[model samples]
Target: MRRVIKNDDSEVKKSNLGYIEGNSNNNLKISKILYKEQKGFCIYTEEYLGRADARDIEHFDPTLKGTSDDSYSNWFLVKHQWNKEKSSKWADYQPVLHPTASDFNERIVYDDGDYRVSELDDQEAINLIKLLKLDDIILADERKKYIQRKAKELSIYGVSPEDFFKILIDDDIKQISYLRAIHEEFKIDIWNLLPNPQ
Candidate 1:
């Protein structure tokens, strides 16, 4: 998972719905803030969340335990499936990387479609990948497909290697962070020379 840059200026507050959400889907006050902060992606998986995927309000720390509704500090936006997988393991494993940390991108490296801890020996990275199954077959395949597609377009269009790297680092394509990391670690140069996507 990438380090999620959570905004300090959150609008959610401690409320009665600490145990679970209420019926009115439109009134998820805190979740609205998190959704905005997360930019419509699962904070854990770093995957885009579309309409068909169920969104879940994940408590980084188990709220059911002694923790009160101070969820603003201990919450995460995850998918329902992932949230279930992370169920009740509050203190069981301390993740090596965190959504709050700003250096997670540089700490963890992605090669092709596999994610592993960097030379820093970030065990939490290992724990998270193992526990969350970040390398699931389909997920890995998708990651590979994404990089291949980008690499193909860059090469096919006769985009200079400089331009390829430039696009990877372009601020307009912040979504390419992970894919860029893959390119860096793999040195993948295959391209299919196609026009840019509209």
Candidate 2:
């Protein structure tokens, strides 16, 4: 997972949702805000939030969802399947890195389609990968396919790596999926490739 920098000034952060229960309209608004904040990518899988895939509001600390502690800081947009897979499973494992608070690249490393902890003994990172099924067969296969397709495109005559990297980073063309895996495969640092680097 990539580091997610929450926009402090976002509209959702200005108000409180802790008191509301089953508020669909507010939930939709929050989802839209989070979708934009996350750059239309799922928090866990980094999958593009397109019409074909289902999505959900994932709580980083699920236990806080209905409690007085519920807030934007605990919320994230994730793939529906991942959310279901993670349901009631957090307590059983070590606390994983928080997208908003932790430097993901520092704790975890992506090698092709697999995710492993940068530090061999980091149990939390290990659990994070397992808990989210970051290296599930299906996801890995999709990532492999994407890497091969991009490699073939790169092999075409006159297709410069620089130009192609721009396309990969271009959100207007398409919201990127399996970003860390793509980075590992291409040996590119996506941050430097941003059109207007943050």
Candidate 3:
């Protein structure tokens, strides 16, 4: 999954904490903001949220749900089903990468349709992959479909590495999914081509 650079404090003002904490209306507003900030992909699954997708505001650290830690930094918009699958299962180990805190691409390697910890052999990264089922057969199959489609598109354009880089940056994919896999399959350092995280 890509590193998620959280939005600044302006949109989720501290003054609205009461409303944000309990109001469904406020939560929807916040979810929309997060969806835009995250480029319409779930932080955990890295799946695009299509019009029919069910999503909600997820507390990254489930244990902190009702505590004072319930704030934007701990919040993300995730697909509803994945959120249910994650339901406080790894709260004690806390292995999942913090979307905004960790440099994801550095800690985890994404290949064809699988994920593994990078050469760093980060145990936490490995745990995160298993905890989230990032490489489950169903998910991998979906990723492979997108990967093949993008590969075909690139092939159609007869792109070299430089040309591919330009195309990736110039026409940013509206649904950013399996990006690391695409980069690895293409033998390109796609992360370098992207601007520094905000």
Highest lDDT against the true fold, candidate = 2
Instruction: State the TM-score for model 1.
Output: 0.65
Model 2 Cα RMSD, Å? 3.3
- Candidate 2, residue 79: how far the Cα is off, in Å: 1.3
lDDT of all predictions: 0.60, 0.75, 0.70
- lDDT by residue (44-116, candidate 2, tens digit) is 8877777677898988888887887888888888989899999878888776776665667788777767777
Model 3 residue runs over 4 Å out of place are: 14-22, 119-121, 159-176, 183-198
- Candidate 1 per-residue lDDT over residues 1-198, each given as its tens digit: 555655555555434334344644634655666676666567766665656778887766554433554556667778899888777554666743554666766666665567677764777776666666766777777777776776687778687755675565453434343433343644543121112221
- What are the clashing pairs of model 1? 4-99, 96-124, 152-191, 152-192, 156-193, 157-193
Better of 1 and 2 by TM-score: 2
Candidate 2 local Cα displacement, residue 102, angstroms: 2.9
Q: lDDT tens string, model 3, 94-183?
A: 566776656777777776677877755676777777777786888888888978887787788886855765676567644456655766
Which stretches in model 2 have alpha-carbon errors above 4 Å?
15-19, 165-175, 187-198
Structural RMSD, model 3: 4.3
Error of 1 at 133 (Å): 1.9
